[model samples]
Target: MTTALSPVDPDSYRALMAAHPGGVAVVTTDDGLGTPYGFACTAWCGVSLDPPLLLVCASTTGSTLPVLAGRGWFAVNLLHGAGRRAADAFAHRDAGRFSAVPWRPSPATGLPLLPEDAHTAAECRVHRLDPVGDHTVIIGEIVRTTTTRGADQPPLLYGMRRYATWPVP
Candidate 1:
C-alpha cells in the first residue's frame, strides 16, 4: 500500500547517515591561476567502470565549487590511515587548509594532489554536473591516476561523527 511520507528533517538525516561509514578523500582543484582549493569528502564513489567515471559531491556554497566548475578539472586524493591531519584540515571551512597539508600538482590536470597524505590520487576532467538540493554532484572522467602507497596501507574512514581507519590484515 502506498502511504504518505513527510519530508525528513535535516538533522535526523545527518544523524542517520553518520551511522554509515565511508572512505574519505580530499577533492582538490585550482582556479586556473596559482591559487588552489580543496575539501575533505566522504560523499564520493566510483560511478562507472567502462569509461572510468567517479562522482563527488560538494556543497553549492563552498568556495571551491565555483573554481571546480570553472576549471572543469579536479583530483581525488584518497587518504590513507596516516592522513588524519589532512582530512581534518580540509573538512573545515578555512583559508589555511592547504597550508595545513603538504601537496603538489597532479601531472595530468595540474590540480592539487596530497602526495604525503593520499595513497592513491586520480586526476579527472569534469563530465557533468548535477545540482541536487544544497549540494552539487560532479561526475568526472578520470584521465590519470597515481598510487603512492602500497596495498598494505589502510584507508581513512569517517562515520558516527568520528574518524577511523580500515583494519590492516
Candidate 2:
C-alpha cells in the first residue's frame, strides 16, 4: 500500500526543521588544493556506535560541499558556548573562516580541527554517501575521537534567530 502525501514547500520544511534544536559543528577538510575549507553545520548527528559512525549534511550549492564529497577524510569540531563568533565566521561566504581561529591539522585525517572547541573532535573517513533532496548525507566511520572536561562553559545553541547559552544550575 502507498500513502498519499501533500507537497510541502521547501521553505516551510526548513522552517519546521529550524524549530528543532540541534548541536552545531564545524566540518573541516583539506580540499587537496593546498587549502583547508570549513563550514559551520548544525546538521551533525551520531549514526552508530559499533563501527563508530557519524553524519553531517552539506548543501549541494555550498562551495566546500564538493571538496568534502570528494575528500576521503574530514574532521568535526563541536563548538563550545564561546564559539558563536567562530561558527558565524565559518558559516559565511568569506575566506577568513580559518583566519580568526586557532586550529591545527588533525593527526589522523590531516583535516583542520579546532583545538579550543569544547574539547570534542572527531576524525573520520567517508563510509557512505546518499543524495537526499538538495543536500548530501555523508556517513563517516570514526577513526579517531577526543573529548575532555576541560572547561565548564555552557554550549552554544541556535534556535529561531538568536544564539543562546545553557543556564547554570
CA displacement after TM-score superposition, residue 77 of candidate 1 (Å): 0.5
True lDDT of residue 111, candidate 1 = 90
- Among all windows of 10 consecutive residues in model 2, the one with the lowest summed lDDT is 146-155
Q: Tell me the whole-model lDDT of each prediction, alpha carbons only.
A: 0.92, 0.81
User: What is the TM-score of each predicted model, taking all chains together?
Assistant: 0.96, 0.88
How many angstroms is residue 41 displaced in model 1 relative to the true structure, after the best TM-score fit? 0.8
Displacement of the residue 30 alpha carbon in candidate 2, Å: 0.5
Global lDDT of model 2 = 0.81
Name the regions of candidate 2 deviating beyond 4 angstroms.
Answer: 1-5, 148-151
Which candidate number maximizes lDDT? Answer: 1
Off by over 4 Å in 1: none
lDDT of 1 by residue, 1-169 (tens): 9899998999999999999999999999999986999999999999999899999999999999999999999999999999999999999999999999898876666799888899999899999999999999999999999998533589999999998999877
Cα error, candidate 2, residue 135 (Å): 0.3
* Cα lDDT of model 2 by residue, 18-44, tens digit: 887777788888886658888888898
RMSD of each: 1.2, 2.3
Clashing pairs in 2: none
